[model samples]
Target: MKKINLENKTILVTGAAGFIGANLVLKLLHEVSRINIVGIDNMNDYYDVGIKEWRLEEIKTKADDNSTDSSWTFIKGDIADKEMVDKIFSQYHPDIVVNLAAQAGVRYSITNPDAYIHSNLIGFYNILEACRHSGDDSGKKVEHLVYASSSSVYGGNKKVPFSTDDKVDNPVSLYAATKKSNELMAHAYSKLYNIPSTGLRFFTVYGPAGRPDMAYFGFTNKLLKGETIKIFNYGNCRRDFTYIDDIVEGIYRVMQGAPDQKNGEDGLPIPPYAVYNIGGGRPENLLDFVDILQQELLNAGVLPKDYNFEAHKELVPMQSGDVPVTYADTTALERDYGYRPSVDLRTGLRNFAEWYKKFYID
Candidate 1:
C-alpha cells in the first residue's frame, strides 16, 4: 500500500456538512497541519437542514480554534452533477477524495429508489471519472479515493461475524444494493484506471449531533416528546454500534494508506482496491443497547431517572429491508491498521447523551 504524506495536500471530502463528513473534516482540520480541505455538498434537506448548517458552523468554530496551519473551503454543490463535480476537481485538483455523500436511509429507499440511483450510483461514477482524469494537465494525482459503504450490504448473511470476504450478493434493501454496487464499481474503476480506493463498510454509527434519521437519535427525539420509540424486530436484533469518533479515526488512518498499486504478470493494473469493516467488533443486542442508552440519557440529564422507559418503548416486528443482526469481523482492519473500533456501547452512548443534552435540551 502507498503511504501518503499529509503535509501540504488538498483533501476533498464530499457531504462535508453531513454527520460523518463534518466530523471527519473537523478532525482533519484540527490534527493535520499545512493541509487544505475542500468540501462539496448539495446541502439537500434529507433531514433537518438546520442541523447540517449547525455542523458547518461547528466546523468553522473548530477550524478557527485549532491549528492555524490548516484551512477549509466548502462548496455548495452535488457530486451527481457531472459539471459541478468536474468544476470542483478542476478548481481544487484534490490529491485525495473521500466520497461520503449519498442518499442514506434504508427505509427511505423503499419510497424513493431514484435518490439512491442518482446519488450513490451516478454521483459515485462522477467521482471515479474525476479521479480517472485528475492527473490530466496537472502533475498532481489523486493518491487515494476512500468511500463509504454500509454493513447493510451484508444483507441476511447467516454469518455471526460479517467478514469483508463474505458474499454480499443478496441485498435485501435498495440501500444495501447501492452500497454493494459501490464496492463493485470501485473495483472496476480501480482495475481500469488504477485508482487506489478503499471502501469502508460502516456498521450502526451513532454519536451526539448525529443524523435525526438514525435510530438512537430518533429514539431520543421521541422520548423527549413523550412519544413511543419503536424497537424493531421485537428488540431481538444485534448491531455493531460504532461511535462517530471511532469511525472518523478509522477513516483518517485509511486515508493515509492506499491499497498497494501492483500489476499482474499480464501487465494490467492489478486493481488496488480494499474493503474494511469499520465497526465495533462486539455486537450489542438491541435491547441491551437501548438499556445503555437510557442509562446514559439519565446520566446526562437528557432523561429523568424516573422516566417511563417501558411506556416510551414499543417493540415491533422488523421492518422490511432491516436485518436481524450485523456483526463485523475487523480482523483485516486490525491486522492492517493495528486499530479496530473499541468504543463500548455504554461509553459511546454516554458521549451521545452528553452531546444531546448540550445541543438539544440544555
Candidate 2:
C-alpha cells in the first residue's frame, strides 16, 4: 500500500451530488488546498432533488470561501451512459476514482429491478473499463479505485457481527445481489488490469440530509405529517446505524491505503483488492432508535414536547428482503486504517434533528 498526498492530485468522485458523495467532495475541496476534485452525478430524483441541489450549493460556497475555486468541478451526467463516463475519464485523467453512484434501496428493488441492473451493473462495468484504459497512451494512471458495497449483502446470514470473510452467496434482495456482484466484478478487473481497488460494505448509514427513503428520514417525515410510521419486523430488528461523517472519514483513509500490490510466480500483476465493513459496531434496536429520535426532535424543537409519539407508531411484519439484524465486524477497518465508526446514536440523532429543523421546518 502506498501513502498518498492529496495535494496536487485530481480525484473523480461519481455521484458527487448524492448524500455521501457530496459530503466526501466537500471535505476534499475545503481540506486539501491544491487538489482538484471532479464530481459527477446524474442528480436523479431517486429522492428529492432539492437536497442534492442543496449539497451542491454548499460545495460551491465552500469553494468560494476557501478560495479553492479551481479545485472543484461538478458534471451533471449519468454513469450508466458509456460515452459520458468515457468522456469524463478521458478529459479528467483523474489520479483516483471513487465510485459511489448506484441505485440504492432494498424495497425499491423489489418492483423496480431494472434500475438496479442499469446503474449498479452496467454503470460499474463502465467504471472498470475506464480505469482499465486510463493509462493507455497517456502518462497519467488512476492510482486507486474505491467503490461502495453494502452490508445488505450479508442477506440472511445467521451471524452476530458480519465479517467480510463470511460467505455472501445468498442475497435475498435484488439490491444485495447487485452490490455483491460489484465486489466480484471489481476483483476480476483488478486482477486482469492490475488496478488497485477496494470495496466498502457500508451498514445502515444515517445522518442529516440523508436519503429520504431510509427509515430514519422517512420516520421523521411521517411523524411531521401526523401519519403512522411503520415499524418493520414488528420492531424486532437491530441495525448498526453508522453516521455519514464517520463513513466519510473511513473512506478517506481507505483511499490513501490501497491494497498492497502482488505478483504471481510468472511475474504478471495480480490485482490488489480488499473489502471491509464500515459501521458503528453497536447494534441499536429499532424501537430504542425511535425513542432517541423522538427525544432529539423534541430537544431541537422539530417536534412538540407534547407530541403523541405512541399514536404515530405502528408495528408491522418484516417486508421482503428485510433482515432481523445487521451488525458489522469493523475489526479490519480499525486494524488497517486506525479508524472505527463509534458515533453514539444520541449524538448522531441530535445532529439530524437540528439539521431537519433548519432544512424543513425553518
Candidate 3:
C-alpha cells in the first residue's frame, strides 16, 4: 500500500468523541507526522461519557509520543454553535474537515425529532458555511469535506444490494431523512461552491467501544444483567456489519480520492460530489449473529456456560425505522480504491467481546 502524506496538515474532525470519530482520529495521528488534529464534541449524555473520555485518553497517549510533535486538541462545544464553529475554523484553518457529529439513533428520533433537526440539519449547515468561507482571509481552503451517511437512507427498498445510484428519497425515519438531506445538501454545496465533498453510506458499524444504543451492544448488556433481550423481527433480520478498522481505512482512502466534476450532457462538469456504500458486502442472520456473540462472551468469561441464554431471547415484531436486511455493493469502492472490508463476522464479534469484558466487566 502506498502511503499518502498528511504531514504538516491540520485536520478538523467533528464528533471526535464518538465511536468512529475516535478511531479515525487515532489512525490519523499514528500515520501522519507534523499533523495537528482539532476534535470537537458536545460530550452529550447520549451514551456513557466514560467511553468518550477513554477515547480521548487514547488519543492523548498517542499524541504524547515524542517522536512526532503531532498535537491533539479537544474542544467541548456544539457544532450547531455558529460562533464557536467559525472561531475554531479561523483558528485552525484545517485543510480537511470530517463531520461525524449528528443526532444518531432511529428510535430516539421518533420521540425527539427536534434533536435531529438541531444537530444533523443546523449543525451540518453551519459546518458547510464555515468550510466555504474559512479560506477567504486566511488563504487556506478546505481541500475535502467527508461526512457520514447511513444505510437507512435505503429505507424500505426492495433491492438487495443498495447502490449510490439508487433513489433514496423515501427515508423511513427522521434519522434517515436527515442523513439523506445531508447528501443532497452536500451535492448542492459541491455544485454551487465547487467544494469537493464525499458522503459515505456506512453499514452497521460495530466494534470495541461501540455505541451502547446499538442492538449488539444493548443485547450484550441485557444478557449480562440476566434480562430478556428483544430479538426484533423475530430474529429473522440480517445486517451488513462493518468493523471499525475497515471503516477507518475506507475513509482514509476516500479522503485522498476526493471527487471531481466531469462533463455532463450540459457540457459542464457534473457536481464535484460522490457517495459510496461502505459495508462488509456479506450479511449475517440475526440469530446466527447472536449465537456467535453469546459464544464469544462465554469464551471471554463475561457469560457463564450454564447461563439460560435461550430463556433471555424474546422474538418480537419489527419496529419502525428498522430494515429487514442491508447489504452493500462495493464494486465502485473496490474498483476505485482497491479496498474491500474483509473482516469476518466471528472475528469482529470476538474483538468486541474482548473489549467489552475488559472495559465493562473487569
Candidate 4:
C-alpha cells in the first residue's frame, strides 16, 4: 500500500471515540509524519462509554510514542454545539475534516427519531458551517470534508450492487432518511463553497471492539450466556459485512483523493462532489454468517464445542428499519482509487472473536 504524504497537516475527526473514527485516527497518526489530529466525541453511553475510553487510551498510547513527534489532541464535545465547534476550528484550523459522529442504529430511530434529527441534522449543519467559516480568520479553508453515510439509504430498492447513480430518495427509516439528507446537503455545500466533500455510504461495518448493538456483537453475547439469539427475518437476510480495517483504509484513500470537477454536458465542472459505496461488495447470507461467527467464538474459547448453537437461535419476524439484503457496487471506488475491500467474512469474524474473547471473556 503506497502511503500518501500528510505532513504538517492538521485534521479534525469527529466521533473520535466511535469504532470507525478511532480506527481512522490511529491509522492516520501512524502513517503521516508531523501530523496533528484533533478528535472530538461526546462519549455518550449509546453503548458502552468504557469501550470508547479504551479506544482513546489506545490512541493516546500510540501518540505518546517518542519515535513520532506527531500530536493527538482529544476534546470532549458535541458537534451540535456551534460555539465549541467554532472554537475548535479556529484553534486547530484543520486542513481536512472528517465527520463520523451521528445518531446511529436503524431500529432505534423508530422510537428515538429526535436523536437523529439533533445529531445528523443539526450536528452536521454545525460541522458544515464551521468548515465553511474556519478559513475566514486564517484564510486556510478545509481542503476536504469527508462524512459518513450508510447503505440503508438504498431502502427497498430491488437493485443488486447499489451504485452512486441509483436514486436514493426513498429511505425506509428515519436513520436512512437522515443519511440521504446528509448527502444532499453535502452536494449543495460542495457546489456552493467548493468544499470538495465526499460522502461514503458504508455497508455493514463489523470488527474488533465494534458496537454492542450490532447483530454480530449482540449475538455473540447472547450465545455466550446460553440465551436464545433472535434471528430476525428468519435469518434470510444478506449484508455486505465490511471489516473495520477495510473501512478505515477506504476512508484514508478517499481523504487523500478528494473529488474533482467532472465535465458535464455543458463541458463545465458538474457538482464537484461525489458519493461512493464502501462495502465488501460481496453479500453474505445471515445464517451462514452466524455459523461462521459461532465457529470463530468456539475457536477463540468464548464458546464450548458442544454448545447448543442451533437451539439458541430463535427465528423472528422482520424488524422495522431492517433491510433484507444489501450489496455494494464498488466500480466507482475501484476505478478512481484502485482500492477494494479484500477482507473475507471468515477472516474478519475471527479477528472480532479474538478481540471479544480478550475484552469480555478474559
Which lDDT value does model 2 have at 285?
A: 98
State the lDDT of candidate 3 residue by residue for 62-83, as single tens digits: 8887367788999999999999
The global C-alpha lDDT for each of the candidates, from Candidate 1 onward, is 0.92, 0.92, 0.90, 0.91
> After superposition, which runs of candidate 3 have C-alpha atoms over 4 Å from their true positions?
1-4, 261-269
TM-score, every prediction: 0.98, 0.98, 0.96, 0.96
lDDT of 4 by residue, 124-177 (tens): 999999877878999998888899999999998788989889998889999999
Whole-model lDDT, model 3: 0.90
Arranged by TM-score with the best first, the candidates are 2, 1, 3, 4
Clashing pairs in 3: none
In terms of lDDT, the poorest run of 10 residues in model 2 is 63-72
What is the per-residue lDDT of model 2 for residues 1-362, given as tens digits with 9 covering 90 to 100? Answer: 77777778899999899889999988887667688899999999989999999999998888777765447889999899999999998898999999999999999999999999999999999999999999886868798999999999999999789999999999999999999999999999889988899999999988999999999899999999999999999999999999999999999988888887789899988779999999999999999999999999999999899999999999999999999999999999999999877689999999999999999999
Error of 3 at 38 (Å): 0.8
Residue 169, candidate 3: alpha-carbon lDDT: 88
lDDT of 3 at 177: 97
On TM-score, the stronger of 2 and 3 is 2
RMSD score of candidate 2 (Å): 1.0
> Could you tell me which 10 consecutive residues in candidate 4 have the lowest summed lDDT?
1-10
